[model samples]
Target: MSVTDTEATGRAPGGGAGPEPAVLTRRLRLVLVLLLTTQFMLAVDFAILNVALPVIGRGLGFPLAHLQWIGTSFALCAAGFTLLFGRVADLFGRRRLFLGGLVVLGVSSLVGGLAQSPGMLIVARVCQGLATAAVTPAALSLMTTSFPEGPLRRKALGLNGALMSSGFTTGAVLGGVLTDLLSWRWAFFINVPVALAVLVIAPRVIEESRPEKRPELDVPGAVSVTLGLLAVVFGLTQAGEQGWSSPGALLSLVAGVVLLVVFYFVERKVAAPLVPLGVLGKRSVAWGNVAGLFAFATFTSLVFPLTLYLQDVLGFSALVAGLSLGFLGLGTVTGGVTASRVIGRFGTRTTLLLGGSLQAVFTAALVCLGADRSWMWLMLFAGFAGGIGNMLAIVGFMVTATSGLADHEQGLATGLATMTQQVGITLGTPVMSAAATTAMTGSGAVAVLGGLKGAIGVNAALVLLGVLSSALFLRDDRPAALRASRRSGHGRSARRKGGGRFRPVA
Candidate 1:
C-alpha cells in the first residue's frame, strides 16, 4: 500500500492503529528530517555561544557577574520548562506546540542578533530557551509516534540521538569558526534561517496529534517541579564552576531538594499529575533513564581530565587542545549512526551492558596514558571509545524508556529522559573536578598527573555501578495502554485483558 493511501485510510504511526513497515512515504522522510533538525538545533544552541561569550560581554558591556547568563539564561529556562511543555503538547497537539515553539525560537534569534543591550540579549536568550523547551520533546515525541517500533524507528531515533549528542561539541567548534570568520552575532542569527526553513516544510510533512481526552494542567506540580529543577541545575552549575561548599551552591542545592520532595508528594495528590508517579515505576523507563544518566555523566566528565592532560602535561596551545576534541565528536556521530544496528543485534540489555563496560574500560585506560606516553594517540582512542559507548547506551535507553508509554505520554517520556540527561551532565563536571582535587595531595607535575589519573580511575569505577544496575534491573514490557487506559478504565474489554500489571511486548 502507498504511504499516503495508508494515512488517508487512518492508520496512525505507532499509535494503537500502528504503522506498516513496508510503506516508504516521501512525507514521512521529510517529517523525520525536519524533526531531527529541530533536535540538532536545540542541542547546538546550548554550546554555540560558549566561545563567543567574551565578545558578547564586551559588545553589550555586560558585567562580569552577569556574563554567565548568556548561556545560563537559555539553559535554565529550557531545563525548567521541558517537562511542563511536554505535557502541554500531549494535552493540546504536538504539531501545534512544535510550530509555536519555532516561531518563538526564530523571533528570539532575530532579537538576540539585533540586541543593542545586554538585557535585551538576555531576554532573547531566555525566550529562545523557552522555545527550545517547548519544541524539543514535542518534536521528539512526534517523531517517535510517527515511526513504527522496528528498524525504521530505531534508525530515526539513533540519528536524532546522535545529532542531539554531538550538538554541543559541534557548537563548540562552530562557535569558534563563526566568531573568528564572521561575528559572534552569527551564532544567534544563524538559527533564524534554520527555524524558517523548518517552518516552511513542517506543515506539509508532519501530522498533528494529541490525547483523545483533553487534560488539565497540573499547576502545583508544574510550579514546584520547575523551581525545583532550576534550583538544582543552578546549584550544579555553580558547584562545577566554583566549589561544592560554596554557600550559594549549597543553598540552592538544599532548596532544590526540598522543592522536589514537595513536588513528589504534590504529584501523588494532584487530580492530573504532570508526570503520573506510576510512570516512574515502569522498569524500562526508570532503568533506561538511570543508565543514560550514568553513561552521560561519565562521558561528559572525561572532558575535564582529558582537556587538562592535553594542556598541562603535553603543553599544547588552547586551540590545539580544543581541536583534539574532534576525535570525540567523530566518535559521537559514528556511535549515533551505528547505535540502532548494535541494539538490533544485541537487544537493549546487552547493548547497555556493553556501553557501560566500554565507558569504564576507556575511562580507566586514561590513567595509564601519562606524560611518558603519546597523549594524542591515547586521548583519541579514549574519545573514540567513550563516544561510541555513550551514544550506544543513549540509543538503547531512549528506546527502552519510551516503550509501552501511551501515545500521548510519549512527550512526557522524552522530557523525563532529556531531564535526567541534563542533570547528569550538569553534576558530572563538579564531581569529577572534586575527585581530581582530592587525589592530588602533593605538589608539582607528579601530583597534578596523579590527581588526573586518580580522577579518571574513580570516574571509571563509578560507571561500573550503572552497568551493574542495568544488568540487574533493565527489562521491557508492553505498556498498560496496549490493552487499556489505566487512568479511565473505560474500555471494558481492555480492562478485562489488562489489570494493573503490563504484559510483555513482542
Candidate 2:
C-alpha cells in the first residue's frame, strides 16, 4: 500500500494488516506495544547515563566537565533532528521511518555498549539521538491514526505521556542499579533487546501511514531551524561554563536568532513549509506548545537540582537519590491517568486552568524547602501537582492543536508540538540551571538554599505565566452538539474498556 493509503487506513507504512477479518486490530495492538516500548527506551536512554556519570568519568578517563557532553550530545542531536525526521516521516512513511530509526537505535546502543573511547560513545549517542528524533513523531502519529477520537485516544495518549515521564525517573534508578551491580555499559546494552523486539514486532502489528498529499520537503527551512536551535541551546550551555558575557556565547546567541528570522521568511514563501504558518496561527497550538516548553523546563530543572541536593545535602546514595525521583514519576502517572476523566467532566479549558494553577501553587511551595528540612510530604504533593499540570497542558495542547487539521497534516502537527516541547526543555534547562548556580555561588548551606529558592521561584513564575496564557488565549467554541458528540464517543469507549481506553481524534 502507498504511504498515504496506509496512513488513511490507520495502518503504519511497510506493515500490512493481515487477513481482512482481524488483521488491522491485531496489527494495531502489536504496533501499539512496539511504539510504547520504543518510546520507553528512548526516554530512558536520555537520562540513564546520568546516574552512572561518575563511573563513566573515572573509567573513561574524562574530566567531570566533559562528561556532561554525553547527555548534551544526545539532547542537541535529538533537538536538532526532531523536525527533520518529523518531516521525513510525513513524506516517506511514518512506519518506515520509525522502523529505520529502531535499527539505528539498536546498532547505536550496541556500539555504545562496547565503546572503547569517549569519542566513540559520544558518536554512538548522537546516532541514538537521531534515531530518537525519528521514533518519537512516528510513534505519536501512529497513536493519532490508530484510535478513533474521544476518551479512548485521551486515555491512550495520557498513558503514553505518563510512560514517557516515568521512563526518565526509571532510567536513573535502573542506571544506578545496573552500574553498581553489572556495569555502566548495561545502560546502553539494555536497548538492544528492546529495539530488536520493536523492530521484529512493529511490522506485524502497526499500520503504515503518511500524508495523502506529500508536501515538498523544506530543506532550507529545516537546516536553518535546526542550526538556529542548536546555536541557541549551545550558547545557553556555554554560559554556565564561560561567563554569560563571553564573546562566543554572545555570537552564538545572535547567530541563532538571525538564522531563525531567516527561517521565518523561508517558511512564509515556501509552497510546502516545513511548519505550516497556519499551525502557528492557531492560538491553541501556539499556547499549548509555549506551556509545554515551560512545563518541561521546570520538570528537567527540578529533577537535576533535586538529585544533587539529595546527594550533596542529604548525603543520600545514588540509589536513594534516584529513588527519590520516583515521587515525581508517580505523581505524573497519577495526573496523566486522571486527566482524561477530569477533562471529560470539567471541559478541557477548565481542566487546563486547574492544572496550571495547581502547578504554579506547588512550584511556589517548593521554593520554601530548605537544605536541612525534610519536606518529603510537601515534595510529594508538589510533584503530584506538577505532574497533573504537565499532563493536562500536554494533552490539552495536542488535542487543541490537531483538532482542525486534516489527516495529512497530523505529522506536521505532531512535529510542531514535539519541537516546541523540546525547545522549551532545551532553552529552559540552562536558564534554570544558571539560576541555581547563581543562587549558590557562595559556599554555605544558606547559599544553597537561596539558590534553590531562586530556581524554584523562577519555575513557579513560568508556570503561572503558562496558566495565564492558556486561560486567556486558548478558546474552544465548538457547538454544543459537537461537544456532546465528543463526550458521547469518549463515554462509549470508556465504558467499553474501563477508564483507560479513550483516544481523542481532534
**lDDT for each of the candidates?**
0.82, 0.75
Backbone N/Cα/C clashes per model: 0, 22
Tens digits of per-residue lDDT, candidate 1, 181-209, equal 89999999999999999999888767787
Error of 1 at 461 (Å): 2.4
- lDDT for 346 (candidate 2): 66
Which numbered prediction scores highest in TM-score against the true structure? 1
lDDT per residue as tens, model 2, 1-506: 22243433443444344222222344455556666777777888878998898898898887877987898888877877787777788888988988999899999999998998899999999999888888888788777766545565566677777778778889889999999999999999999988887777677666667756677789889999989888877776676557578888799889989998999999999998888788878776677677677667777667766776676666678788788778888877887788767766665666667777777887788877766647666776787777777777666666665556655666777777677666666667677777788777677666776777788788888888888887788775444755786777856766577666655558
